[model samples]
Target: MATPIYEFAQIPRVDPAAPARARTRKVRAAGQAPTVGVIYNPRSHRNLGADFDCSLSPHVHIAQPRARAQLPEALADFAAKGIDLLVINGGDGTVRDVLTCGQAIFGDDWPEIAVLPKGKTNALTIDLGIPDDWTLQDAIDALDQGGRVWRRPIAVSPAEDGASAAGMSRVAGFILGAGAFTKATQAGQSAHKLGAFDSMVVAVTGVWALLQSLFASRANPWRKGARMRIGLGASGVPMEHSGHGDPEMRQLLFASTLERLPAGIRPFGALKNGLKLVAVDQISRRTTALIPLVLLGKLRGGLRERGIHQLTASHFTLSIDDQFILDGEAFPAGDYLIGQGPELAFVTP
Candidate 1:
């Protein structure tokens, strides 16, 4: 096979040092850019100039690294710099890094963050009002629009920093992983160049991936078994034992903070208003029943008993093997604990 036909400078690394607020981005106007900050996992960056030039506005204060190794230190650094608003340029993992950085730095002063959709998932970006930008102009619109302030809930986990599963990062704007859904991104998760950012191109990629999964599933030899313990409100009473029961099936707990999954996962939009807890108990139970409602691209669904837009947990702890996937970015960390931190703010689109 031939080598990749692209340059090497367009990758982004995950660094948590409080990303420096966007100072001289050029697109930001004096007193208008808000206290902007940028964090990108360059590996997720496409070599397209639109990705670079569109974000070159004066409003952007950037802290970019060539690899993911710089994330922790960068988050710490950005926090020390004191950013009022953070504009992340990578995918879901990078978004979580920003959330963690906010908690590490200005705890209560957590800045409202906007996600600039640039990665394969761009999951949080679409969760916000912004979505996949097919054209260069569309990309610019996201940049200009992301610089604005919007209000949204930040999933607060009661766990301490770096203690829970993936630490105390915000949700609603971030994705979580638990089951077969997350294990499928190995082929298309590239942050390389010549990235086909066109809308139709994404459609084709979706179909191709599905076909591969179907064939691979036929050849695979794994049967359902106990992977971890999970639940909805309590740890294991069963969230879906009432109808269409699966007395013998064991549901692997695969949850995401967002209402929808990246790429081919589905949603009609019901997930926009509340946090979704996708679970596995017995195979007969439906996980994310509202997912179809969300995939339809509509944001209507049943609300919590109190009509709340988000769920606040004292601290959700999951005990399992180290099989958890964070923001679709697999980690080598042990799965002893996992949850959201105290309080971090997220600007939904």
Candidate 2:
């Protein structure tokens, strides 16, 4: 049985507040002739599906479908080709890589991104309404028709201290987090060789890892639990220290880009162009609480009053016990602090 949502009170609240957003911004509408770059990561399941529908797109200036050691080369090639929009055909990791690559090669004036939900858990793409089953022909057709595409702002981590200080340290397109949730994702990825592309499978695997860590991992998780000292914000304001303060003790601190999670238990205002911040202390209760409310795709029986779907934080960081997963890919610097890494900018479909 899962624990209760109230258990989250065990988590210390950070000064995280709602994201302050102005009107949505757009770089290129559908009709504009935006030169496209296709940096497909063939290794991920999402990019390999449906006969490589992404690679076959007529609009994109295609490069080899892989994340090279020195990714800047690929971006240089695309930029040299004058590609205006960079279409990423992979999961969250791939998307993150693309952002870094863009920063390295193009700096702040980089191409906008269009994602193909070719990842295991396409939480962001799904939020963007990029269908689970998309065809290249359809996308091309839509672009030709100048379909009404939606645009959303991607979050950027506060500038860090380094050669690439202005570069993105972290960019959350769909979700960013620390704590047990990150550990769970890292653990689940250990079995990546035996994993599937389906979101349900990945979620189950992530949960398995969470349980394993709770019960068996060598880490001292139970006594102290996973806690991080972070500051969150939105609309460019700090949301990390007050009635909406940072959590003193949290098992999982997550900020999501979309309103809904699995089974359509979307956070409020996610679809309305905002992010959601949730700090979790007891997974069992959260699981239970969110489960019943997930009736097909709508909330029911007093479940809707549980939490807010929209939250914002500008400077959020954590001290974690395990490596966290950004989107789906795990990093080598997984164990250390990534002072504001990975930035995400979006493109309308």
Prediction-by-prediction clash tally: 61, 45
lDDT of 1 by residue, 140-253 (tens): 344445344333333433222453413333332244444343343333444223454323333544455334433443223111322444433435333333222233332333
TM-score for all models, in order of appearance: 0.57, 0.63
- Local distance difference test, each candidate: 0.43, 0.48
Question: In candidate 1, residue 332 scores what lDDT?
Answer: 36
Model 1 spans > 4 angstroms off: 1-33, 47-60, 67-69, 72-82, 134-173, 187-226, 231-252, 259-274, 281-315, 332-338, 342-349
Highest-scoring model, TM-score: 2
TM-score of 1: 0.57
lDDT of 1 at 27: 34
lDDT tens digits by residue: candidate 2, 223-254: 12454454443222322332211235455556
In candidate 2, stretches whose alpha carbon ends up further than 4 angstroms from where it belongs are 1-34, 46-60, 106-112, 146-173, 187-196, 202-224, 233-248, 267-272, 282-310, 331-349
